[model samples]
Target: MTVLLVDAANVVGSRPDGWWRDRAGATTRLLVRLAQLPERRLSGPDGGVVVCDGVVAVVEGKARDVPAPDGVRVERAGGSGDDALAACAARLAQEGTPLLVVTADRGLRARLPAGAAVAGPGWLLAALDETGCVPPA
Candidate 1:
């Protein structure tokens, strides 16, 4: 199964939707949108197809309190969200699960385990738009 790990802060921040005003609200909206998505078969940046089987969002700071929707799992970071994401990625990689991390942070991208596929927030946002999962901006 291909697991998609989302950097909630990064993805939410990618869009200048005024997420900074209310981090928790923005996170909740993002999670709700994610829950509404049907199983997706997306084109990877490397010209391959990526089938997203499961989704996990790592939340931190003010957004940590946002509850997860039915189809999404929320991981609250006690401190650094990037650290939490890296740990999750490492664990998933060790289990031999195909992993895809969604984020635009170069440092976090560098920290991900080997064999883990990485996609930027633009990729995710475009997919959401294609599926009509995002609200009108």
Candidate 2:
């Protein structure tokens, strides 16, 4: 299965879109977008494969309790989001699943398994927008 790991704080904070005021709200919005990602299909030469089988949103601080949508899992980081992300990635990698980690933090990227696919926040945001799943303001 294709596992998509999202750094909730990093993705939400990627743009200066006033997410800091209500972190939980922003995280909820991101979860909505992430839920849509797995349903997205690329056409034509891309062969119409689904983007992901599941999405894991690693949330911390004020965003920990955001409800997850179907096909999405929320990982509450009682401490560091980066640490939680690393742990999640490691677990999935050990299971031999294809891992795609969404984050812009270099340090977090360094912690992922060697074969984990890494993409920046803008990449995910653009894909969400393309699928008409823009995050709420």
Candidate 3:
């Protein structure tokens, strides 16, 4: 089973799609999109099928209060979202779980444990689109 760790703030901030107006709403939208994804498979970076068994979205700042959908777990960060993500990644790595981290932050990417697959928010949005999880424009 592969666990997907999302940096909610980074992903929500990527498109500049009026997310600045309401961060929590944007985060909620993202989580709803993620929850809509098919449970069995997603397109991998290498063009193969990646099984996503779990999803964890780390939310910070004003977005921390946003509720998560059924298939997605929302982690409200007490401080830095990046720090919470890194810590979760580290714990998952220690448990020998395959991890896919979705974020565009360079520093946060560097902080992730080795062997974890990293993808930018663009990739995530593309996947969501491919899966017909389109959000409102």
Query: What are the per-model numbers of colliding residue pairs?
Result: 0, 0, 0
Q: Estimate each model's TM-score.
A: 0.92, 0.89, 0.94
* Candidate 1 C-alpha error for residue 51, in Å: 1.2
Per-residue lDDT of 15-68 in model 3, one digit per residue for the tens?
Answer: 978999998899988998888763757898668777888898999999988877
Model 3, residue 125: distance off in Å is: 0.4
Q: Give candidate 2 misplaced runs (Cα > 4 Å).
A: 42-50
On a 0 to 1 TM-score scale, where does candidate 1 land against the true structure?
0.92
Score each candidate by Cα lDDT: 0.86, 0.82, 0.87
- Against the true structure, candidate 1 has what lDDT? 0.86
Q: Predictions ranked by lDDT, top down?
A: 3, 1, 2
Clashing pairs in 2: none
* Poorest stretch of ten by lDDT in candidate 3: 37-46
lDDT of 3: 0.87
lDDT of each residue in 1-137, candidate 1, tens digit only: 57789999999999897899999999998888877553777776577777778888999999999888899988899999999999999988998888889999999999999778998999888877777787424
Candidate 1 minimal-lDDT segment of 10 residues: 128-137
Task: Give the runs in model 3 whose Cα sits over 4 Å from its true position.
Answer: none
